[model samples]
Target: MALQIFETDPDARPAPKVKSEYTRPAFTFRSGMQRNRKPVKLDNWRIVAEELEPLKALAELLGGTAEEYSASAREPFHVLTETDSVEIVIDGAGAVEERMILWGPNGPIHECDGVEFLSPADAKGKPCGCPKELDQRKAWAQQGRGPKPNIPIRFRLAGLGYELGFGLLRISAWTFLPDLDPLKAALAAIDGEALCTLELEHISFINDKGEKIEYSKPKITVQGAYADAIAEER
Candidate 1:
C-alpha cells in the first residue's frame, strides 16, 4: 500500500522573502570593533626586495611561477602585522635575511636586519647588551655542535592575505618568521614541492624576570615538521 506523507495542500504559497536587520544592518555586534571605518582599495602596488634568497625556501615550499622569481613585483596589500589565523594564498618569495631580535629590560624592543648589525656599538643605543645567546648559537653553528634548536628564521613573503578584496587592493611584501607551529608543519609536509595553505596562530612568551615584569614577548607557535592543520587551542 502507498503512504500519503503530506497533510497540507500541494499548492501552498511560499513564504515571502523577509530581509532581516542582520543581513545588511547599519550596526552589528562587531560595529564596536570596526568603528564604522571606511574600507579602502588601490589600483596597483608593488613590492621589491634587493635580494630573493631569503624567500626561496618558503617560496619553493609554496610553489610559484617563474615570474615570482623577479626581485620586484606588483601585489595587492602588505601585511601590517600578524593576524589571528589569517588565510593566505602564497604567491612568491623574497630574499632571505636574518634579523637581530632585541629583548630589553622592558620587553621585546626591535628587530634589525642581521647584516646591518655590525658590532657592540649597536648595543650602546639599546638597553640590553649584545645577546650572549646569538654569539653562542653562531659559535655552535660554525663548529657544527651545541644545542641549535629554535634558531630564528627570517624571510620576506608575498601573497594574497585574503581571497576577497576590491580592485584597488593593498599591495605589499613583508618579513615572515617561521617561529609558529603551523608554518613549520606546512613547510615540512610539502612532498618535494607543493602548494598549500598556512594557518598561523599567535603565541606569547612570558619574560620570567625574577622580579615581576609588566609585558611579555609574542611568538607564533611551532608544532610538527609539516603543519597542515590549524594549531590546537592551548
Candidate 2:
C-alpha cells in the first residue's frame, strides 16, 4: 500500500508583513562652530584615528579576503565613526570612489553585501588593536593600502555623513570609550547624562551580482536623537 498522509482540516491565511523599525536614518551634519545655538552637531563628529584602521581588520574578520591587496573596495555604502564613536563617514569619499548608498528615510532595505552581524557579547570579547591582524591581512596586497584610514571621514555640512566602499564591509554594535567627544555630546543631550541607553543603528547594502537593480532600494530612519542633534547643532 502507498504511504498515506493526512492533513488536519485547516485553512491557510496570508501572514501580514511586519516591518522592522531599526534603520539608519538620514540627516545632515553641520559644523558646530558656525551654528551658534548649541555646540555643533558636527562637533560630535570627529575621527578616531587608531580605532578605524582596526575596523578594517575586523571587516576582514567578518568577510573580505585573507590576503591584502591594493584593492580599494569594501562595501557599496558604509557609515563608520571614529572607534571613539565621534566622527562618522556615511557614503563615500576617501578609499571609496564610486558612490552607491541610497538616500532618504524609508527609502529601501537591502540585505548586506557579503556582510555578517555579531551579537554584542561576541563583539566585546575581541582582542584590541589590529596591527598584527592588519599586517597579516594586508601583507599580500599588491595595490597597496588604499589611504590610511582618515580622521573625520566626511561631514555632509547640511546633510548626513557618508563613507562609501567598493565592496561589502561594515562593523555594527561595538561600544566606544568616554573619551569620544561626539558621542559624549549626543548622549548628554539625548539622555541628560544619566548613563542612559543609546542605539547605534547599523545597516548593510548587498548587490550580490548587480542583478537586482530594481529591488536594490536603500532605507534610512534618522529621527529622535539623530534628528534632534542635527536640529540643535544648526
Candidate 3:
C-alpha cells in the first residue's frame, strides 16, 4: 500500500519485513534494476533536513539518545520532472520540531542524513560544478566502508548522468533483527537532523541501443539523511 503523505492520514507504510539488510529496499542502481534489460529507470528522490540533536551536543557529540522519527517523501510521481515535490517528518530534542514539505523539480525526496553536498548551491564554495562534487564523493565511498551504498541512482534517460542521493544508517549493514528492527532503525533514535537537500550529479546506465550511457553533469537534488546524529554535544 502507498504510504499517505499527509498527517491527517496517520498511515504508516507497513514495514517490509527485514528479510535482508536493506529492509526499506529503496532504489539502488546496482541490484534488481535490469540495467541490461531496460534502458532507464526513474527514481524519485526527496530531501528534508532536521536538526534534533542540539541539546545532546550542548556539551558533547550528543547527550543520551534522542528518539526522533522522520521520513522522506515524494509526490505520487510516475516520473521525476523539471520540477519536484515532497515532504519531511522531524522530532528534535523532544522539543523544537516541525515539518516543511516542498514542491519543485529540485527539492528533497528522501530522509538523507549526512554532510552530503546537497545541491549546486552546496558546491558553491568549491571549484567546478556538481560533477566534481560527485566524483570526489564516489571515490570517497570506495574506501571499503563495509556495506556499499546504492550507488549510481538513475531517475531518467537524460543520458550520461542522472541525479544522485544516498541514505546513511549509522548501524552496520550486518545489524538486522527479525521483527521491526529495520523499521525501528530507519525511524529510530534520530537526534541529528536529516538533510533532504538537492543536487545534480552523474550516474551510469545503458541507452535504448544497449550501450553504456554516462549521465554527465545534470542538476539532480539528492535530499537524504545520515542515519546518525550530529548534535551540538551535551
Candidate 4:
C-alpha cells in the first residue's frame, strides 16, 4: 500500500539511522612528545647592525640588516641606457684592467655609416685619430690585436641632457658600488655629486657565425640623480 503524505500510522516503526562512509574525521592535537612533528621554517627575525653584540668591532667588515616591513625602500630608481654600452675588462686575477664606453655601428661617433678614424679637425685632442667604427678601432685594440671593447656593458647617463654634446662617454668601472671606505672615496672623487645604481643584466650579442649568445653582468648608471636622496646627501 502507498503511504500518503504526512499520514500517521499506529503500526509504523522508527527507521534505523545509517552511517555515511564519506563523513569528515575529527581533528586531534598531537602531544609535545610526538616524534613526527613538522619542522618550523623562518619562524622569526631580528634587525641588527655590526655595531651591536656579536657584530661589535666588525662594523668595518660587516654590514647592517634592516626589516623589509619596518624599513622603507629607497627612492629615485635609476634607469640604464638600452643602446649605448660600456665595458670593464677583468684580468685573470679578477682585477679590473680597463673600462671603456662603446658606440655601436650606429652612434654619434660616426658622421656617416661608413667606418673610419676621427679627423684632427674634429676635436681639440691630440693629433692621434679616434676610431669612428669597429674596423677603424682594430689598430687601437690592446697590443694592436683587435677592436677595442669587443664586448660592452651598456648603461644610461643621469642629469639633464648634458652628455649629448660628447661623442664618446667613458669612465673607470671603480666609479661604481664601492666598499664603505671606497664609496666614501668615490663620493669625494665626484665632489659628492654622483648618484648611481648598479644592476645585473642579461644581454645578447652576435658571434662570428651570426648566432646570438647571452651573458649576464653588472650595469652601472646615474639616471636617478634628481630624485635620489643620496644625491642630496652628497
Candidate 5:
C-alpha cells in the first residue's frame, strides 16, 4: 500500500456543543438572605439573575417588580423578583441528591455525604468523620468545622408559556431535610411531569427558654400535570 497524506477541508466546522437544560438555568430561586453574619429567612422566594430582561419578564408574569442591585466588583450585577409562590414544571429528573458542601473564600473546600468525602479529589471516599447525631452535626456545621446540606432543584416556570428557560432552587436549610424523600418520591411518581408550587411557609414556635422564634421554610407541593392543572383551573 502506498502512503498517502490527507488534507483537512478548509471550511469544515465542528458540531456545536449542546448544553444540558439543567446546567443552563436562566435564574436562581433563593429562600433566604444574610445580613451582618446573621441569616434572614424570607417568606417569599427571591428570583435572581445576572440579566435584567428575563427578570423583567418574570416580574410582569409573576406580579412583582424586578429591581437591579449593584454588587461587588467581583460579583455580577443582580436583578431580582420576589414572589410568595410560583408554579414550576420539572420536566425531567434534575439534581436532587443531598450532599454536604463546605465553602471557603474561593469556593467549595470540601464536599461529602456525611460518611465519606466526595470532593477535593485527593480526599474523595475517605471517611469524613462527621458526627453521627444530627444535633452534633448541625453544631459542627455552625462552627464551620463540617459541611452543610446542599440540595438543588432545577425546573422550568410553569406559566409564561414556558419560554423563560429554567430556574435553580438550592435548599440548604437543615430543617428541610425531613421533606426531601417524600418530595423526591412525588417527583418520581409523576416522572417529573408534575406542576409544582414552590413557596415559603412561615413557621413560628416557642423554644424551651420561652423565647419565641419565627422563620420561613421553603415548601414544594405537587399540583399534578400542567394540562390537568390548567383544565381544573378552567
Candidate 6:
C-alpha cells in the first residue's frame, strides 16, 4: 500500500448554522430557603431564568417581584419571580400527560400508568401492582413503594407572547391528581387551545392529634378559547 497526503482549507467549508440556546422555562409552585441548617418551604409560584428581562416581564405581568440570586459558580447568577398565580395558554390536549414516576437521586428509576410499569426498559409492560383505590395508593407512596403523579403541562405565558418561549408546570404531588381529571376533560373539549390560570391554593387545618397542618395545592382554571382571549385583548 502507498501512503498519500492531502491538503485542505478549513475556511473553504461553509459555516454551520448557529444553534439556539433556548430552553423551555418552568413554573414552580414551591421554593425552599435554607434556615438553621435545614430547608424551609414557601408556597408561591416561581419563574426562574438565566436572563433577567424575561423574569422581569413575568413578574410585571403576574404581579410579583423579580430578584437576582447567586446560583453557583458555573452559572454564577439567575433571576427569579415569585407569584401566587399566572395566566397561560395551553396549545392543545396533547400538551399534558398524566403519569406516575418514581425518581431516584439522579433521575427516574421507574415510571407507570397507575397500574403497570412503563419504563426502565426491562420493567416496561410489567404489572405495577399499585392499589386500585386512591387512599391505598397514597399509603403505598408514603411507604416509598409507589410512584407519585408526574403530570407535565406545557403552556405559554398568556400575555408574554411566545417569543420569550414556553413554560412547563410539572405536577408531582399525589394529592393534586384527583383535580386533574376535570381539567383534562376541559382541555379536550376546547381542543387544548384555551387561556388558563395556574394558581397555588393554600390549605390549612388541624389534624386529629391537634397539630396544625398547612400546605398549598396547585389549581388550574380554564378561562376560555385562545381566540376569544386574544379577541378580548385586542
10 residues in a row with least lDDT, candidate 5: 72-81
For residues 11-62, write the lDDT of model 4, one tens digit per residue: 5656678885222211100011111455222111111221122222112222
By TM-score, is 1 or 4 better?
Answer: 4
Clash counts per candidate, in order, are: 22, 30, 47, 2, 0, 0
Please give the distance, in angstroms, between residue 92's alpha carbon in candidate 1 and its true position after superposition: 7.2
* lDDT tens digits, residue span 49-153, model 1: 223332233234334311232223322112122222222222212111234544445643544343333235655344332335666645643464422222233
| Candidate 6 accuracy as TM-score | 0.77
In candidate 3, which residue ranges exceed 4 Å CA deviation? 1-79, 83-190, 198-200, 204-212, 215-234
Off by over 4 Å in 6: 1-23, 26-43, 50-53, 63-82
TM-score of model 4 relative to the true fold?
0.25
Give candidate 2's total backbone clashes: 30
lDDT of 6 by residue, 1-234 (tens): 553332266556566888764354633333333446685555766555555666666777765666655555222223334566777888777788888887787888768998888886788899988889998887877788878888887888877777777777777777787788888788888954899988878889999999998877778898889888777778
lDDT of 2 by residue, 1-234 (tens): 753333342244345788853223222111222223453333122211112343343333333322322234331222233321222223322311111111124542211111221113454334322233434423322233211221222222212123421122121101221123443343334432111121223334458775532211111222334454555888
Report the backbone clash tally of model 6: 0
Which candidate ranks first by TM-score, i.e. highest?
A: 5
Alpha carbon lDDT at 10, candidate 4: 42
How much lDDT does each candidate structure score? Answer: 0.30, 0.27, 0.28, 0.30, 0.77, 0.72
For 1-234, candidate 5 gives per-residue lDDT tens digits of 753333355355455789854546678887766667698777667777777778878777766677655464222333344578877887644446678998999999879998999988899999988889999999989999989999888787876666777778888889999998888878777743778888888889999999999988788888777667777888
Look at candidate 3 and tell me the lDDT of residue 93.
Answer: 26
The TM-score obtained by model 3 is 0.19
Quote the lDDT for 171 in model 3.
17
RMSD of 5: 5.4
Better of 3 and 5 by lDDT: 5
RMSD (CA, Å), candidate 1 to true, equals 25.3
Over 4 Å off, model 1: 1-83, 91-96, 101-130, 134-234
